[model samples]
Target: MTEITLETRIAKSDEIVAGKIDDEFVMMSIDNGKYYLMNPTGSRIWALLDEPRTIGELCAVLTGEFKITAADCQKEVVEFIDQLAARQVVKVG
Candidate 1:
């Protein structure tokens, strides 16, 4: 398992295909044939992963986009990314 830290760079896994449904996303993993759902916030994060980004970068972007506190943003983003990592739907380095 990858240790997720502020400097960890993350990217979308190539095995997954994602489709948008309004604000949410439905993702299918071609490698495992597993389906997953991402809420609006998760969908936004997925779209941002067009390139690898450090956790801090993602936090910075989210802080700028939402009214949440920096601490809260980091905490929640880490948890959400962990879920994605657990599913092998994202790559963390």
Candidate 2:
């Protein structure tokens, strides 16, 4: 697996089915039949994944919307994306 960096582009995996309920996002991996739930911030990231985006781009947008420093946002976002990638809910390139 490729390491996720600031320049890495990411998008939702085709094998994952997802939906929004109220303020949260729920997703299921067709390959494993495992379900996942996301908080508001994660939901926002999921929505942004409608188009492939660089990790840097995601951090930029999220920092603008939330009160977080660039470094902290990048760290958190990278960790979150790593989890999603591991679950095959997202594709990283």
Candidate 3:
């Protein structure tokens, strides 16, 4: 089985808001009123925001779905989560 290093475990997804705008997706946290613009790849991650997922799982999923490098995906995934954290969209479990 794959593992995830998710810093935040989304128990209640109500805290975050998601919607599509034009060709892009946007997710916002009602708690902090902070919004994140989700690109194609980011949107994929957003779609999988039901619960906590390990970094490895995310990396594997992304790599399998897209033609991206695992290392690159890992870095981006961590950075994206960091951005979400900065906005208080997610919290450490």
Each candidate's lDDT (Cα)?
A: 0.91, 0.94, 0.68
**Model 2 misses residue 78 by how many Å?**
0.5
Candidate 1 regions off by >4 Å?
none
Per-residue CA lDDT of model 1 for 14-59, tens digit only, reads 9999899999999999999999988888888998998999889999
The digit string of per-residue lDDT tens for model 2 on 1-93 reads: 889899999999999999999989998889999999999999999999999999999999999999999999999999999999988899999
Please report the candidate that would top lDDT against the real structure. 2
lDDT of 3 by residue, 19-45 (tens): 887757787778778777878877777
Backbone clashes counted, model 1: 0
**Model 2 residue 27 CA deviation in Å:** 0.7
Best-to-worst ranking by lDDT: 2, 1, 3
- Candidate 1 TM-score to native: 0.95
Candidate 2 lDDT score relative to the true structure: 0.94
Residue 62 displacement (Å), model 3: 0.1
Off by over 4 Å in 2: none
